[model samples]
Target: MEQFEAFLAAHLPSAASFHPHYETSLHQMLLGGGKRFRPALLLGVVQAYNTLLVPSAYHAALAIELLHTYSLIHDDLPAMDNADLRRGMPTLHKMYNEVSAILAGDALNTYAFEVLSNAPFSDKVIVKLVRSLAHNGGVEGMVLGQAIDCHFENQRLELEQVKMLHIHKTGKLIAASLQMGAYIVGRDDLAQQLYDFGIDLGLLFQIQDDILDVTQDETQAGKTTNNDEAKNSFVTLLGYERAMDEANALAEKVTRQMMSFDENLQRELSPTLTQYINRHKD
Candidate 1:
């Protein structure tokens, strides 16, 4: 994780030369502490296959993190969720201004693709990385899910509808993270399996998040709690107990699926998934 942070610091656009406030806002948000789950997933897949880190893998990981950061920024915008806090701090727009926040998000989004395209890999690999990211993070994936979420605001959404929305919004990039790692290591055989696992993992993560929003305090969570009651969340639809049960079930399923891999790989990957699940159980 430290290595990945160093890589980002070295490659990410410097805030030193740009509009001081704008660049500083971007730097603070991008470098802010959080679970680097997406990049970990990508790197875990590569380690499972090759047991070694690759330069292109680092680039891909950075790109995914940058993209994820951009999503968080935009999600908190006044036009979106209107969130005033993120990672326990004032959101970018709240800290600076709306226009600066928007431009920072835009810069991160474009820079992600730029990093991926210039990764030290074959053209075929680079193309695959770009396409996978675009497909999962673009119109058909996260964006579509966000659109649906905003469209259905204040309206009751059915179970399946909520699943579809989250699968696209939160799950696709996660699944793509695993797939991207598989591509980096040329593990085509494991791509589909990793993606399948990612779907369950992503849902589990989100469900736990929903549960925590109601169960934990703002200080403990490092973000606002009880904010999803008005949204189409599992806790809102299924109630807290049922949602927790669902999360536990998904965690069991993910563990079982991980066991399908080689013993060594399973051992290597299980801890990260386990920690992710256990972190929100309170």
Candidate 2:
């Protein structure tokens, strides 16, 4: 966690620079706090590939974080999820106003590329990272998921459609982060395996989130609870028990995939995966 903190600090824009006010609110919103799950996932992938090159892993990890932060900022906007609290703090829009939130999200989105360009790796690795981030973070991935989510809100959606929504909105970026770590270590096979693992892991994460929203407290969830029934969500279509069963099955599959790796990597990720699955707002 200290390493993750250092990575965030290293990539954060300094306050001493001009235009600080413009960037300040959004930066503070980001720095306020979250679980930092994405960066840790990237780091885990790197560790699995090989324990060397921790600094490169940190850079890639930071890039994933930036992209994630961007998504959160935009997701909280009035036109989107209209979220008020995020990660237990006032959202970017609530803290800095909608325009500032939009700009902040835009800045973070672009900065992710900048961070990738600055990574202490070969140009080949940098290019691969850039391409993967763009593909996963752009229209083909998160953006498409958001579009689908908005389009289906207040409308009934099939289970497959809901799964597709999560795959685009959440799974793609998770897979990309793991793949980036693999690229850094030159392990294509591990990258592919990790990518597949991430897809299942991400879907499980989303379903668990849906479960929490229905069963947990807003404070623990860091946002509004029971919003899924209002918006199109897997829980709405599949019901709570079925969603739980699916999430558990998916988690088991993810754990099985992790087990295929050496014991060390599986052990490292076990706590991470368990915490996510069992997290509660009670």
Candidate 3:
């Protein structure tokens, strides 16, 4: 983790033009500190499969982090969530300007592919990595989910439709994170299983976030809270108690799936997975 952090610090996205705050804004949220959950998932898989490749896998991990950060930056925009806080700090649009925040997000989004391209791997492997990230983070996955989410605000959705919205918006990229790690280590066979687990995990994560949005304060949650009142969030549709039940059930499913993995994979991922698999209770 220390090594990955150092790599991230050294490889932060930068623009060559002499735009005053452009470069600064590009690096701010990345440096501000996030859960780094996606990166951890990728690296943990690589370590489990082949520790020798862990160092090389850092590039993939970093790419995912860059992409995830870009999404967060955009998600906090006034036109989106209208959030004022993120990562325990003022949101980009709040601290600087919405234009700065948007451009920075674009830069980070493109830079994620650039970073992945530079990773020390064969061209074929790089192509696979690129496809996984782009497919999940792009229009077919997260963007589609966001579009549905925003378009459906203030309008109630059926429970299954709500799950579908979150599965596309939040679940796909997370599923890709685990799959990308499988690609890194040439474990395509396990990728599907891991991805399926990650999707459930991601749903649990969103439900938990919805719960936290209403339950935790700004100081405790480190970001805006109670901001989903107008959205078709799980809490809004299922109510808080039902949402908790769903999270608990998903957590149990994730645990069972994790235990069913190859012994070595389970052992390697336990350190990271344990911390997050049941985070709703936290």
Candidate 4:
């Protein structure tokens, strides 16, 4: 993890353009630091299979983080969640301006693909990695989910429908993260299984976020809280207690799924995945 952080710092995207604060605004959110959950999942999978590939895996991990940070930037915009804080700091739109936030997000979004294209991996693997990230993060996946969530604002969706919303919006990218790691390590056989597990894990993550959005304050959440009143969140539909029940059920299922992985992969994912799977309990 420490090595990955150092790699991230060393490889921090430099706008390098004449626009002065553009670069600063771009770097601040990425550097502000969230959980780095997706990157660790990808790198952890790679490490379980090939330690030597770990360094090369950093590119993919950074790519995921970049894309995710871009999403957060856009999500916090006035046109979206209208959030003021993220990563325990002022949101990009709040810290700078909406235009800066939008442009910065766009830059990071494209740069993520560029980073993946230049990754120090085989051409075939890089292609697979790029496709995974793009498909999951593109208009059809996370973007679609975001669209659904936004379009359905103030409208309550059925339980299964809400699950589908999150699966596309939040689950696909996470599943892709694990799938990308499998590609990097030549564990194609495990790709589908990992992706399936990641989907459930991602759903758990989103539910937890919804619960935290209500239960915690802005300070405790390190971001805007109680901000989903108009959104079709699980906590809103299921109630806090029911949401906790759902999380507990998913946590148990995810833990059982983790046991089914090969011992080394299980060991690799245990630290990060287990920590997150059970985070709602905290």
lDDT of 4: 0.93
Any runs in candidate 2 off by more than 4 Å, and if so which?
A: 15-20, 280-282
Note the clash tally of each candidate.
Answer: 0, 0, 0, 0
Q: What is each predicted model's overall lDDT from 0 to 1?
A: 0.84, 0.80, 0.91, 0.93
Per-residue lDDT tens digits for candidate 1, residues 155-241, read: 999999999989988999999999999888888887888888888788888888888888888788776677775689999999988
Pitting candidate 1 against candidate 3, the one with the higher lDDT is 3
Query: TM-score per candidate, in order?
Result: 0.95, 0.94, 0.98, 0.98
Instruction: Report model 1's TM-score to 2 decimal places.
Output: 0.95
The digit string of per-residue lDDT tens for model 2 on 1-282 reads 687797787679543657646768647756877878878777876776578777677878888888999998899899988888888888878876898899888888888888878988999888988998899899899999999998888888888888999999998998887788788888876778888888887887788788888887778677767666667776788888887788878877876787787786686677677677545222
Error of 3 at 282 (Å): 2.5
Q: In candidate 3, which residue pairs clash?
A: none
Residue 96 error for model 3, in Å? 1.0
Instruction: State the displacement of the C-alpha of residue 45, model 2, in Å, after optimal TM-score superposition.
Output: 1.7
lDDT of 4 by residue, 1-282 (tens): 889889888887786868869888878988887899999999989999999999999999999999999999999999999999999999988887899999999999999999899999999999999999999999788999999999999999999999999999899999999999999999999999999999999999999999888879988999999999999999999999999999999999999999988999989999998678878888
Candidate 1: which pairs clash?
A: none
How far in Å is the alpha carbon of 24 misplaced in model 4?
0.6
lDDT of 2 at 97: 83
Tens digit of per-residue lDDT, candidate 3, span 226-253:
9999999999999989999999988898
